[model samples]
Target chain A: MKTFFLSDGDLDEFVTNLIAKSPVFAPVAKKTRFVFNQLESVEDLRLDYDTTILPPKKLFVPTKQDLVTFEHGKYEECLAPGKKILFGVHPYDIKAISMMDWIHEESNFDIYYHSNRKATTIIGSNVQNHYKKAFFGSVCKELKVMGHDMFLTKIADGYLVEVLTKKGDDLLPDGNFTDVSKEQIKNAADVNTKADENCPSKLKNTSLEIKHKIRMYYDSDVWKKKSENCFSCGSCNIVCPTCYCFDIQDEWALEPTSGKRYRRWDACLTCEFSEVSVQGGSENFREERAERFRHRIMRKTSFLNDKLGGPACVGCGRCSGTCTADIADPVSIINEIMEK
Target chain B: MSCSSNHDKNIFLPKNAIIRKASQMTAFETHFTLKMEDESEFIYEPGQIVEAGLFGYGEIPLGLSSSPTQQGSFELVVREVGKVSKALCALKAGDTMTIRGPLGKGFPVSEFVGQDVLIVAGGIGLCPTRSMIRYIMDRRDEFKDFKLLFGARSPDELLFEDDLAYWRCSSDVNYLETVDKPNDRWKGNIGVITTLFEGIDHLDPATRVIICGPPIMYKFVIAQLAKYNISEHHIFVDLERRMKCGVGKCGHCQINDKYVCMDGPVFRYSDIKDLEEAI
Candidate 1:
């Protein structure tokens, strides 16, 4: 509801104090890129980083975590919540996390996800630097996740912090900071708009012909030729913020009596992902690597058009970045299909 | 839409259903007649299925064999191939099982009223077809003619012997049964059920054919129906998929873009001919 401008010196002091007081995670420079980790020093908070090595989804849904543990015919699931703060998130990654929030809340609400989500206080920042591969600003106008409690934008001399939720209001006391002058607000808005304008390529202006041509190119030879290098390691799916497919497994104890039942993330790119309980599963579905390649595109664009309102892909570019074969970019596939 | 303070929102939770009757038809198959505690009607269409379970073990999808027209008690004929089914078959009459269902899209019988009906079932796939068979028998006066054809691996595996005998006595209904192999005591037709179509003129081109059974039986039966110049829309079938969560969320039992649990376990041939995952 209210905004305040903190000077560069004050910004450092504020971050240092927060890190010392709370369990805070911030973007730290990792080789050529940045990653979210425990903020040991104030300087490690890379406010100008374009993107992180991994999106902040790991905080909500960990890469490898137990769903629940059980013993002796009694089952107890832990949908535990914790208190923490995540700082310096880019708009695109923030948008991806918010989309996951909606999915976990709708219909069959996931208790495990919701609990962790409620405990975390998100402090998102406007993108000051653009990753070359990012096209999200054009697709969805990369804006602050309205769901986040506290949001920050970099201005000329300092950072402009906006308090949007009760959690944000709690962080800011009565006399925390003075007025966010009109000049500061105007300058912050200008920098944010300039960043958005520079993010998307000129290709965003053209009409996409991918969907119509993809229908015709379902049996095309291009996919087969291109997908020959795929190893089916499913690394792309593991890194993606939107790939939510999973497999359920039940584990009995060494005594063969009682144990835990849990679900783990699964990827369609893997051979065993679509296997049926019965014999002779649909090898036809994933017979060729190209079919699997094209099916992922169809699931994001068309199948989602019928089920969920929008395409499932948020244009985050995580799949393309994670793919070892350099053939997973749906945008390039879309363009090629359209041209054909 | 029916949210209330007293009403529990969990549809996945099972109600206590006691197995009132259990009969062993084949070495690998058993029929369990279950009745719920509330005594409310578990009203559902012909091809819908229910999830039955033992408390600490697990659950499996079992097709509803009894018709919705016959309420109070429902029946499921399960072939014991997996762990859950094998555990289910071990239970005798008066055993309790938890059940949640009457789920999924079932065959549209109202659309087939007053038209000639062709019913075909193969092996253990006859369970869902039995629902339609019983329904058609009850409402026999509303239809023109009824033809039933069933095929199993052998004569000893045929389900519902008493009901089959009663149908044989009915004047409006003509039933033909076949097995892959005929033993010394066998006196009926011996071959695939498709062969029983020879010289049989019971169905008009306007007749609606409802067939269910194993996945392998569908294409062959469809080819025979097409030989009679029947339109794809006139033929309906039920599908079996690995269904868990009976609601669409579990992500199993999907056929292309459709969820078999919600969009259909029953669908017209024309509706899903283009779907790659469909049989």
Candidate 2:
């Protein structure tokens, strides 16, 4: 628990030194929201932000990743790692990534994902600004502690940085900062307590209750009426912090003799997501629009909890914010389930 | 832990296999004999599927039809029903394809060795059960009796004609086949796969029954098998789902907490009878 404090000026100096040395990825301004991007300068980083359009999971399990390359009746697996610094990760997002890590490495273990994850350094920051629907603290107390090489908390006039790993210790430039005092430690704890108090009034850890309500309403007609406007656009999946479904494909060169096999992010919201060779599609089991809608919610509530200890939703509010049909808000759906 | 050892222990990815032999058994279907790059044998029990992929194309779950006793290569009977299989059917001999499997939990062959085995296959469902048929033949001395009740839509739709002929001639096996619609030359039973089970002799209560087919076939076949007094534990079925990652990471293959790719593509009927999604 190596703790240090840096003034706003010193923070800029540290950011500049870190960017010059390694590839640092942090949130940058996009239109009205923010997105994780490679930091080129101190000014490019946003230390105080609500949430990014995409979670930091993309840094490890990318949208499109090459699995192997084959040619001329021979095949060689290509597994590469990217050296990076994942910056500005909120605790909820970190919690989501940790769950994903467990899933990818649990049974069979994914070499591609595990290798990429090893080469990256994770830097987490306290949530100074919470999304309107954010409620992860109640679900898992994720805001208090998470898996990160480094954690940063905003204080009155400076930032309290806690280095949790050797990789985090290596990121310090000049290594000159005010030593942590008792008062500074108390300030860090107060900031975290305030963040937990900021959750929306409707949000609660009644997750098991939500699961029961969802099961009771599995056959309800309200889902059909609510999901009628969906175009199966898959925006909810694309923006979700925990959705990890992918589609693998081969890309042959123009000559058709050789190519690389790769996998890209896929979504159940898409019509062809369930297409297979034996039967064209198995999603027919849940063919109705309403059924698909309920299934996604069921995944976040019951299925993921059964598999990974708790719900997969980090309560980041990205799904609700990105849905075009205006019916993808998970909190609203949970609220409706609770009403029953 | 060291990063290298962590990665070395995580090589569960599918390997590329070559199509050593291929044939169009039906107008819409083709059977491919696949061999791994390293030439290692694909040792899998009957009623398992591999994630077969055509490079530059896509992937789909195809049942393993060849017996594991046959070393160095395995067989998959592919139907050109979708984009991936359509591409697979277009490939010829000597062409290379990618695959990852022996993935799902296959049939409990060890548990059924000395008992009577009743196999019911419907339409193309005969593809998976073919593995069990070949296994029983390879180790004929170990089993008590072999009975095959298979059905398809037409004579042309029946899979592995040569193999069926071999099973029909074996003394230890009682083989019967039917087609839903018959031609003038056809002289066998004329009904669904379930109807053929009615004419078969009494099966022991310890007899193990294996079924593979569309969801609609299970309800009828299991009901008919139930009359033979076989307990649910003695009954097994292979349930196929759309699987992308055969390692169980992908949610597409899920039926409740069970991922058809890992937990099972094969299951004891007693274990999954309560699973509403399974027939």
DockQ of each: 0.23, 0.45
Residue pairs in steric clash, candidate 2?
A: A250-B56
Cα lDDT tens digits for candidate 2, A238-317: 88888988877778877877888787888877766655545444435545677667678878877767666677787788
The candidate maximizing lDDT is 2
RMSD of each: 4.4, 2.8
lDDT of 2 by residue, B155-178 (tens): 878788888787779786899888
Error of 2 at A288 (Å): 2.2
Q: Candidate 1 DockQ category? A: incorrect
Task: List ranges where model 2 is wrong by over 4 Å.
Answer: A142-144, A173-175, A278-285, B1-6, B9-18
Q: Write down the lDDT of every candidate, Cα atoms only.
A: 0.73, 0.79
DockQ of 2: 0.45
* Share of native C-alpha contacts between chains A and B (below 8 angstroms) recovered by candidate 1: 0.05
Q: Which candidate number would show the highest DockQ if scored against the true structure?
A: 2
